[model samples]
Target chain A: MELENSGRESVLQIALLGGVYNNYLALEATLQDASQRGCDEIYCLGDLGAFGPYPDRVFPLLDQYNVTCVQGNYDDSIGNGLDNCQCGYTDPRDNHFAQLSFDYTLANTSSGNRAYLRQLPKEIRLERYGLEILLCHGSPRRINEFLWESATSTQFLEYLGKQHQADIIVGTHTGIKWLRQLADQRWFCNSGVVGRPENDGATNVWYTILDIQTGHHGSSKRRALENVSWRHVPIHYDYRRLACEMEQEAIPTEFIETIRSGWWTTCLEVLPGKERRRGRF
Target chain B: MTTPKVSLTHLDQLWFQVAGTLCNLTCHHCFISCSPKNDSFGFLSLDQVRKHLDDSLIAGVKEYYFTGGEPFLNAEFVDILCLTLEYGPATVLTNGTVLKEEWVERLRKAESLSQYGLEFRVSIDGFSPESNDPIRGNGTFGRAMDGVLRLVDAGFLPIITAARTWPMEQDAEILDRFVQMLRDSGYAQPRLKILPTLQMGAEEQRTHGYLDSERLTDEMLTDFDFSQLVCDHSRIVTDRGVHVCPILIESPDSRLGETLSAACDDFPLSHGACMTCYQFGAICSNPSGQAYRVKSDEHGT
Candidate 1:
C-alpha cells in the first residue's frame, strides 16, 4: 500500500531491502519487483561480498541495477585486510558452526570486493527527499549497533537527538526491516540484509516504500515535516538457493541451515561446532 | 511469626533464572551483565525444575516466572514452560530476538494444553535501534521485534516492557509513540510496563553501584507494604535450588534452603532493589492481565 499521506508530492524513497548474494534468481526477481514498485531510487544496503558463492555474478547485477551501495560491517573488515569479519556481534559462547562462518566471511572476501568496501562510507546522507536520510552500514551513531523496532521510543529518541538532523533515518547492519518514530521528530528504519536472510527463520528479504502523500491532518502547511508517507513492505525470497550456494561456498553447513530455516541456532558461544567440520551449530 | 533481625516475609511467587547467564545478544545496561561468557548462573535442567514444582505445590505457592539473559536462548525453554504450566501460571521475560516460527508454535501448543495460562513479556529499550543499540547492541531492535511478531503469530499476546531512561514527565508522550510503533509491528493490543533501572549487577559497574543512600532501612518500612514485593509471595527455581523470591534469586541470602519445601522459611529483603519493590508494589506480577491467580496473602498484605 502507498504511504498514507501522499496525495501528490513525490515521496523521497530509498531501499537496499536485502543483500543480493550471488543468488541472482532471487536477486533478479527482487530487483524487478522493487524497481516496479515506484521506488524513487534504489539503494543497496551492503554485504556485497563474502558468504554466498555468486559474488562475481551478483556484483555485476548490482552495478547494472545502479544501486547505491554502502559498506557492511563484514565488507569493511575484509576490505581492511583484517582476517576477522568485524561484524561486532559477539557471542561469548559460540558453538562450532558460528566460528566457522565468521572465519569464512573473513577469508572469502576477495581483494576486489575489499577495495570497494574500504571506500564505502559508514553512512550516506540524503537531502533531496526533503528529509535528512542518513544511509549507513549500521546505526547512525555506531556501525555495529543493532537498532530493533522493539526498542523503546525514549531509547530511540536518545540516539536520534545525538545524531544529525533528519526527518527519516535508515541503516542496514541488522538484516531486518523495522520502522520506528522517535520523540525528537525522527524516523528510524532498518532494511534487512539482502545477502543474508533475516533471522525470522523465514526466507524473506524486506524493504520499505516511502511515497510522498499529502497530509489532511493539521495541514497548516506550517509543519515542515507534514506531508510524507513511509510504508515498510517485507517480501519472501528463495532461501533454498541461497542455502545451496552457501553450502557450495563452504560457508559452513550450520550457517546454511540457519539461512535456510530462517531460525537462529544456538549462539557461537553456547555451541562451537567444528570450525572446519560440517555439522549442527 | 517471629520477626527476625530483618523483616521476614513468606515466599509469595516462584521465579527462576531459567536461561541462566547466556544471552543471544548482550545489552550494555543488563543488570546482571549477562553475555556469552557470563554463566555466573547455569541453565536449570528439567529435572531440577521438576523437583521445585513438587516443593512449590507443597508450600502452596501460587505463581511462577522464568527470566534470563534471554529466556528463549535456553534449548529447553518450550519444554520448561510446558511443565511449569501444569503447576502454576507462568510468564517468560525475553529480549524477543530469537523467537522463530517453530518456537512460537511450541509455545502456542503449550498454552493450549495447560490448565494455567502462559504470558510473554518482550523487552524493547527504545522504539528503534538508534535508541536501543547503544544499550542492547547492534541489530538487536529488529531481531527483538521479530520475536514479538512470532509471539503474536502463536496466538499469545505479549506485554511490552521498557525501562524509563527518559524523564518521568515524558512518560505520556513516550508511551503514545511506543503504542503506535507496537501496532505497526503486528501487536495491535500492546500491554506496556515501564520499570526503573536497578543499579546493581552489570548496571552498577556500568555506572556505579547504589549510592550509600539508596539502601533500605527499618524506618523505610514504616508505610511500606511488604506484599508489593514479589519475594513476599514468590520463590525461584534454578538448577542450584529454589530461592525465596525472583528479585532476590541473584543474591546469596535469597537462596533459601534449596528445595522449595525447605526454602519455606522467612526471607530478608535486604537488597536495594527490595526498596524499589517496597515503594512500587507488584512491579513484576504481570502488571495488568495476570494469566493465573496467585494467593497474595503469603507475602503479606
Candidate 2:
C-alpha cells in the first residue's frame, strides 16, 4: 500500500498559515490547533505585523512553535525600513490606512525582530511524500502579487507550477483562501491569512492543512497521482479582544470594525469585482 | 536623439480589438475616438480570434481582454468570450448601452462552467444623466444602469469603469455617488474602477491634448519602473495586425507586426498618450492588474 519506491517516507501532514498581521491570539490558536491535529510541520508565510496590536508578541510564539517563516511584502517593508507596506492599494483612503498601520508596526517592532524578518527567505522549498512543495507569500515571481481565486486562472496556476517546478504551490497575501487543481495532480493553494476574517461574515480566520500520502490510484506505475488532500481549517480566536487592543492603540477604527463584524472595512479597492462583491464593505 | 524603447517583458495580457474602432456611444473623452460608423478597423472573425488564442497559449498569456467601438456589436462577441474563457480569464470593455439579457445569461453559464473569471467592465462617464449626458450622450446613463442591473440579475458582478471628468478634488464624492446610484439600481455590491482621462482623440478637443513639452526623455526612465507601462506587458491583436498597446491603436507607428511573435519588438515612448500611461500606471487593466506606484526614492532613476 506504500508508494515509497524513492527510498523516502511517503506521507506528510503540514499546516500552512499566511499573513499573521500581528494577530498573536489567532497565531496561538492556530498553533495549538495544528499540534492537536498531529501536523508533522507548521509554517508561517511571512507578514508578522500590521493591523493588530503588540507586534512583539508574535515572535515568541513563532519560536515556541518552531514554525518556519518566509518573507512577505509587509515583512520586507518593515525589515528594510521601507516607506510603505507595498500592498498595492491605489485608493487614497486605502493608502492612508495602510500608512498608519505600517508606521505603527515599524515604530513598535524591536530592531532584533526587524533583523529576523530581513533574514527570512522569500520562498521556502520542500520535497516530501513524492511532492515538490513551494511556499511563498505571493506568487513565486513577485512578493506583493495578489492571486485572487476568482481572477486567477487554472492555466495561469499551471504555468506557475511549471515555471517553479512545484507540484504544490502555496501562497497568501490576498487574505482569502482557495485552491485549484492543475493537470497531472499539480495544485495551487492560497493558505489564506489569520490576520483578519476573510471578507465573509464569519469571525473565524482560516489556514490550510495539506495531507500528502501514498499513491491511491491502485496502479503499479510509480507516476500515479499522490493522495494530496487540502482542508481550510478555521481558527476561532478572541477577535473581540484583538479589536479592543486595536482601539486602545489608536489604530484605524475601520480595521477594528472588520475584526468585529468579519467584513473588510479597508484595503478593498484592490479586490476584483467577484471578490469585492463577496464582502460587505 | 532616439526615443526610449520598452521591450515586451511578457505577454501577460492579450487584447482583442474585436469590434475595432466602433462603439455605440461617442463620449467626448473617448481616447481612441471609437464611435458609430467608424469602421477604420474591422471586427476580428471568430476564426481570427481562435488563431490568436492558440498562439497566446504558447506565449504564456495570463489573461485576455476584448474592446471595441463595442465588443457586443460583433455578432460573435459572446462566442468569442466563451472560447476565451476556456484559455484563461477574459475581460470585455463595453459602453454598457447595448447589452442583451440573453447574451448575459449565456455568458454567465459559460463563466460558471470555466475555472477562469469572465469580467465585464461597463463604461459610463458620470453618476447621473445630467452629468453624463453631455459627455456620453442624451439618455445614456439610464441604459447603462439598466445593463448593470441585468448583469447583476444574471449573477454577474460587472465593474463600472468611469473616466475622471470631474475636478480632481471631487473624486471621492463622485465615486461615493456612483456607488450609491448602482446600489439603488439593484447592484447591491457595485464594483467601480476610476480611470484617468487620456487627452487624445476626442478628449483633445473637449479638454486639451498633451502639451508639447509633455514627453518622456531617456532621463525620465532612469529609475522608473517601465513595467508599469502596458506596452511592457501587453499587446493587442486586431484585424489589421498586432498593435503595440490598446491606447495607441490609431497611431500609424503603433502597429508592430501581423503576428504576435513579430510584434514582440520594443516600442518607442514617442506618443503623448505614453505620457498618460507614464503618469497613471496600467490605466487599461482592471484594478487587479494595475501596477503599484513606485516608492518616492525609487523615482527618476
Best by TM-score: 2
* CAPRI tier of model 1: incorrect
Decoy 2 TM-score against native? 0.92
Model 2, C-alpha of B63: deviation from truth (Å): 1.5
Candidate 2: how close is chain B to the reference, as a TM-score? 0.96
Model 2 alpha-carbon drift over 4 Å, by segment: A1-10, A129-131, A214-227, B291-301
For all predicted structures, in order, the TM-scores are 0.49, 0.92
lDDT of 1 by residue, B241-267 (tens): 776666556777767776766766766
Provide the overall lDDT of each model, using Cα atoms, as 2-decimal numbers: 0.61, 0.86
What candidate 1 gets wrong by more than 4 Å, as runs, is A1-281, B1-10, B289-300
Instruction: Provide DockQ values for all models, in the order shown.
Output: 0.01, 0.37
- Among all windows of 10 consecutive residues in model 1 chain B, the one with the lowest summed lDDT is B290-299
Cα RMSD of all models vs. native, in order, equals 19.7, 3.8
Which residue pairs collide in model 2, if any?
B22-B69, B23-B69, B222-B301, B223-B301
